[model samples]
Target: MLASLAQRFIALTLLATVGTAVSAQTLSSDQRVLKIERMAHGLDIPWAFDFLPDGSVLITEKDGDLLHLAAGRLTRVKGTSKVLDQGQGGLLDVLIPRNFDRTRRIYLSYSKRLGRGSATAVATGQLARRNTQLEGLRDIFVAAPPADSGRHFGSRLAEGPDGTLYVTLGDRGDRPSAQSLTSHQGSILRLNPDGSVPRDNPFTKQKGAQPEIWSYGHRNPQGLTFAADGQLWSVEHGARGGDEVNLIEKGANYGWPVIAYGRHYSGLKIGEGTTKPGLKQPAHYWDPSMAPSNLLVYSGSMWPDWRGDIFVGSLKFGYIARLSGQPLAEVEQIRGDETGRIRDLREAPDGSIWFLSETNGALYRLSR
Candidate 1:
């Protein structure tokens, strides 16, 4: 009787272990059926996309143009402001106001030509249907100093929960400017709707610091969004390998040139070692380099299983990566799509995932 009981117990234990292994594999499977339907094409390096209340989308092309798409049709909007249109400098991001349907207000970020170089500028305008073409119509805000640079002009904008606009500027390929309190480059800035600095900003009380600066020491923050926890998160491209997903906090310093998990393009060592006393560490880092561009946290009803997952677009691998947990473990990779460079990713009002392909200048809608 004792020998028979031992055999039965061993059999049950083996079955339980196999069951657990199978469950884990199913969670991380790449078999997700993602159907990509082309919505619009013929755009030039479409950088970002925002959805309107009536199911229309406003897309920004890197070559300084804005195209409006509605009901599977494309229309070039008129009255677009003049952009610098140099290498990596042009119109970048577009966002609609929280109450867009009632106000018809839109916000934009672009590099405006100024003297020797160009400066990243933010403007608010009204979208009006005049004559036959839709017009951007006006500018409500432009940066003051109007500085210029060819690289690292991080022009990403995100609206906060309090109606304030948050803007990010790269170091303009200048390493020292990132450490300068007076410079707007390599910093996350906070401002009111009309270009005024908010009093509650982190550096507003500091004498030498720019009042608009919310946080500093970023290389090139391409992705910014507020998560379900009401915490802001940003993903920046590291030099060679160290792409990072960071939890943004007010007045915090994220060590850039001073310290990084990545090395320079020429394979030289970057500033100081990886960890410092005061600097914040990224929640996650990609070693082999994913070339992360755009990030969005899934909060839709269509994919209930992906409700809390964070979706990141990759330019190097040409895949959409899904991350989960506080430290971000790779859950799955959605591959075999357009294979073009994905500049931006946004979740539409109808719970569909929309991706903007920079090389093809096309919008792809992904539905399960």
Candidate 2:
């Protein structure tokens, strides 16, 4: 039985690799003026980034390496822990706390190996400098045990203005698990900084539901952030062609698998087709999907025309899309004609846009 399970795992990993390659080959747009000047190579798939107060950037590679990029040079930070780098799993998101300059603390999310599969875990650690090496040395929060599956584990972390931690969990590739209140998969979990459940979470008083649950019914939300208006926004990849950008609300269900604008991989229809009475519809959705990953709402000064527009990185289309207008009516796929897979995008402290390329392992800085 163990051997059979291992075989299944290997097969899934191969499928994911093939799927990524197939998606990467499809992006052929020529609309972007930007070009990636490779700052560093030989780093594995760099997933997310956080800029420090000293003008350096901390980048997390999916294969469990931490890199420090400063003064146009990339150096690997030592003593980082090994991650369970399987399909759609690895070192995920990184964030420097709002008071990091004083507190010296940073937070991270990654897939940690359990018995056979893995579970998403978050850690807070100080930057320990020792003889030219920096290390993130401790863990603060680890989620409950997940079942033995190689998929989903939607591990993105976001901090609210009030400092609550919001973590998203994927459905573990099991669509039915999304509706189960007892499971952590397919849920947006809210917690205190030290891993305690928030008392005011939506399911805190509900019977059989986990208190960590803020909202449920998400598929695989890779992107999450708090807008300038204090509203939470998320971008999630739908099954075949229904990528979504949603305005996340407390205690609401953003239907996945149940009511998607996209279809199943086998070409079958999904759920009841987008209009359930209880579920909230997405603010924007992409059909013939862009495979949206990281999301950023631009309130920066460098791109004056892009102010208040939301930028989303696209893996399938190899570009960044900007969405704007009152009531968020228009969607513009800018920089879509750029090079490689646009994996993540973040706003720098000086109001510039920084992005990551997953395929070629490069970083880009965009300004007016």
Candidate 3:
């Protein structure tokens, strides 16, 4: 875990203070000057970001704005689809695939208006040469049976090593729907680059099952990432204190509303206990919910000691959580005023850490 490295970081400058820092046990006696620099500012609800082939960055704001940040300058990208922008729904995630340079294509997940209600949708488009607009935007996949309430729209996107796309969807405040394969609610979907269902998907041939469904029974899974070994991992929000980090597999049942470690908000027990015969247990979990937002498996290019470690952002506690070890437990809490309500965590191409703070409405980079 990076907690031990925290002791070696000596602050070189002080910014406006917003919260107290947590102390960690020293991992090494070698001290290095830690720099927390604000990269971009004046953002509003910036939900997600991804690196472009040209070394710039694309950031999405929950309110339907796509931002381009390069060399300390910010530009608003045009041609984004219209989003609901209510409750938890909005333009959420922006992703650049491995073949970005060749295709000039990018993907987005957002809350789209379906009928009178709203549902999660994924769209793809080409970034203009100027990086000032998105062109030919079109929806490839849209979750079904939209919900009236904007409570749970789990919209996160990740590209697989094999070029497929994985999209996470929430239960839409409908608990029972998680167990229903007829609906896309509370499910992880696997699709080809062109938005077609992969023939090898676990439920593709199953009767009465949604062909796109890869895994189900999840509750508000907002964080998803692939490990260096190609192992897929995800983190989801629980009702009260059951935030979870799960190792995802094909055709697995994650038992939300059927089995859970935490109870309902009203102090009532959830499901038929924590474990069921067909349900998968969380690889790691949090009680007193941290409101986890994004998940990252560090490459350790900058800090070799952190290679393969897990880093997650906590929206509720305003900190970045570091998890490592065989069993995957929290080894450190990296917090400060600049980290307030971290909405996203990304590892830059150069191996530094960049994150968006909702409370501060700015982008920050952590480096030594």
**By summed lDDT, which 10 consecutive residues of candidate 2 come out lowest?**
20-29
Q: Could you give candidate 2's per-residue lDDT for residues 30-115 as a string of tens digits?
A: 34343233333444688888888888878888978777766555555666666898888888888887887776777889888888
Sorted on TM-score, best first, the list reads 3, 1, 2
After superposition, candidate 2 runs with Cα above 4 Å error? 1-41, 129-136, 326-330, 336-338
lDDT (Cα) of model 1: 0.78
Q: Which predicted model would earn the best lDDT?
A: 3
lDDT of 2: 0.76
Error of 1 at 182 (Å): 1.1
Candidate 1's C-alpha runs over 4 A off are: 1-29, 130-148
lDDT of 3: 0.87
Alpha-carbon shift of residue 226 in model 2 (angstroms): 1.1
Clashes by residue pair, model 1: 118-148, 154-170, 170-186
Task: Provide the lDDT at 167 for model 3.
Answer: 96
lDDT of 1 at 353: 84
